[model samples]
Target: MSAYVSVLPQKIPRQIAGSKSLASMLPTMLSTGVITLVATAVMRLLWLGFSNDFFGAWMEAWLTTWPIAFPVAYMLRPMLNHVSRSMSQPVVPIALPVRQGLMVSDIPHAAAEATRIAGLQVKSLSASRY
Candidate 1:
């Protein structure tokens, strides 16, 4: 009987062997490649209709668009990420007047005041619902 032992590396490299900057760009490159390929194929199909030459046309369009898409996606990724992060954040509550015939901006304050007058602590809008 023969026994075989398999050994794994102590530490795996974070990236493949190549330029460090290229490694950082892998996500953007891959995403852009997929997006451009799908978009070009769809657009080509819509514009020219599916036919005998569809595959060739789609390939040409994808090849042309991918180069342009990659650079644009790489440059815009940071700004897009920032915008997405800001949009996903919870909105902060703002103070407004607590009075009758209040403006739209004062609805939350009026709601709070109504609850206060009713002897209920204003934990949140839902907390003070009638």
Candidate 2:
């Protein structure tokens, strides 16, 4: 109805200006998950349909090896977008942890100092260490 159309813009602006919205991102995430699931399912069904030992072995190997492809595609997407935007090549994202020694115990003081330095109000810090 006209009421829904009129209220939609107030809900979602044309430009979020570097902000992310769950409403917009959720569909993308869902589609990605669904595509991954469906592709795997279809490939599996096709592989299972073959009765020959050689083809069955091949299909089994293919299904087992398929997980490695997703990480490559996921890593490439940002790079491809940047490549399209400008001449800069995509940088590889390392899946390493940031710092080994820092944990939740170290967070309170650093967070408090950071808040103080940033001129933000300091609140009580509560933490539990195992």
Candidate 3:
């Protein structure tokens, strides 16, 4: 009906507003929470071994850190965005002169040493290799 069509657009604006608000706020809330939880747990565990009262300590640490982390995250949003943008750049392959000096082994640090010996610059994360 004509009446329904006119009313629909008006209602749509309210839906759009709600969706935009949630879209912007949800990521920040989730990242802040996840970061807070992990940071608190790791720091607390290191500071006060896995004592029986870990739950209490974690809650206390989270309460203390939340106030600080929330503001810092908001303040650092621009800087973080820039850093994230830079990190997401496509990886470029660099051809390094292969040195046959170091032996390649299944052990973890051996490969790192081999790369170092070869003077190769590798990405922290290899895309297709992983």
Candidate 4:
């Protein structure tokens, strides 16, 4: 059992060598690729409406750019997830004590309250200590 456990980590990489992480990305990658292509096509159509020669020249450039952009957008999923999750959770607001609708911004008030509570607690504990 000990020998088998020792060799487990070495076997994991070999198992992953033939597998496809890229396959999991295909649906998402293709969707974004299509959207980019459509937006490019729309711009080309608008340009063609004004000037056909310029649109034809730019079409080849847009097509070539997509191959690079598609892979990059696919790879960016993990980073996007991290950024979104980090931003989504809200910061806990600090509790501020209010006195007669006024914020009690004095440190002494907190210290006094804590001392009073601790004194009462200590008295109760001492009464019960056995």
Candidate 5:
């Protein structure tokens, strides 16, 4: 019996060198790549409807936009993450007095009164349950 030879290479060269920094950037790189790919294709389609040149135009646009998008997205990722975290948390509503017929001097008193009224309302609500 003749021995079978595999066509595939035994060792594949690493495309990207793995490191701590690269690991940190991997998520941003992947997300930016996917977002830019879809956005560029969609925008190109919208601007110039399906044609024989559509694929070429879309590829060109994606190539141009991705370089710019990746750096901007990487830089803004921290701030955006912070904003997203802040937005996702539960928000506590503060009672504020309506501005109608209220003077600057009465602002403090009005706020205090609003808080007092709010506390009373809460107490009443809890009391009603019993």
Candidate 6:
């Protein structure tokens, strides 16, 4: 039992190696790559102005900037997840008085109210309008 227990810790590295941390970092790498690629290229071009060696300068800047961006972006992932979750949650509909009557901005409620005021059933709203 003790032998088996001792082997478990030793096996953890093998598992980690198998998963390839690089694979996990792929999304972060790709997203940050695109952002850094464009940013570095544009900034270098703008600062130095156009040159026959633009491609060389862009590649150099991109390589240097990405090392910094990758770690920063990876570290920010948790905060990003939190923000995205909060933003993505179904917004609680606030009940507010319609100050200007129903603008097209109002949704089903506006349609229902119009249908009701017109002496037509809600179902009639879905019916063909001739």
lDDT of 6 by residue, 1-130 (tens): 4555444545334433445777778889999999999998889889989898888999999999999999999999999999999999986558954375546767877777888899986433545665
Candidate 3 clashes between residue pairs 3 or more apart in a chain or in different chains: none
Compute the lDDT of residue 49 as modeled in candidate 6: 90
By lDDT, is 2 or 5 better? 5
Please, what are the lDDT tens digits per residue for candidate 3 over residues 1-130? 4556444445334433556757566667778988999999999999999989998999999988887887678778889999999999987667865455755553568877888999998877768777
lDDT (10s digit) by residue, model 4, range 1-130: 4555554545334333444875576777788778777777777767665564766655675777678787887789789989999999987667954456525676767767888987854333565567
RMSD of candidate 3 to true structure, Å: 16.3
> Best candidate per TM-score, number?
1
List model 5 lDDT by residue over 84-114, tens digit each. Answer: 9999998656696445686899888887799
lDDT score for residue 115 of model 2: 88
* Local error of candidate 6 at residue 57 (angstroms): 2.2
Can you list the residue pairs that collide in candidate 6? none
How many angstroms is residue 108 displaced in model 1 relative to the true structure, after the best TM-score fit?
Answer: 21
Over all chains combined, what TM-score does candidate 3 have? Answer: 0.46
Clashing pairs in 4: none
Per residue, candidate 2 scores C-alpha lDDT tens digits across 23-123 of 45544555555666666556666856645564566556555554555455555767877888886655656896557687788888898899889999856
TM-score of 6: 0.55
TM-scores vs. true structure, each candidate:
0.59, 0.30, 0.46, 0.47, 0.54, 0.55
Candidate 4's TM-score: 0.47
Residue-pair clashes per candidate? 0, 0, 0, 0, 0, 0
Kindly state the number of residue pairs that clash in model 6.
0
- Flag regions of model 2 displaced more than 4 Å: 1-7, 10-51, 87-130
**Ten residues in a row with the worst lDDT in model 4?**
7-16
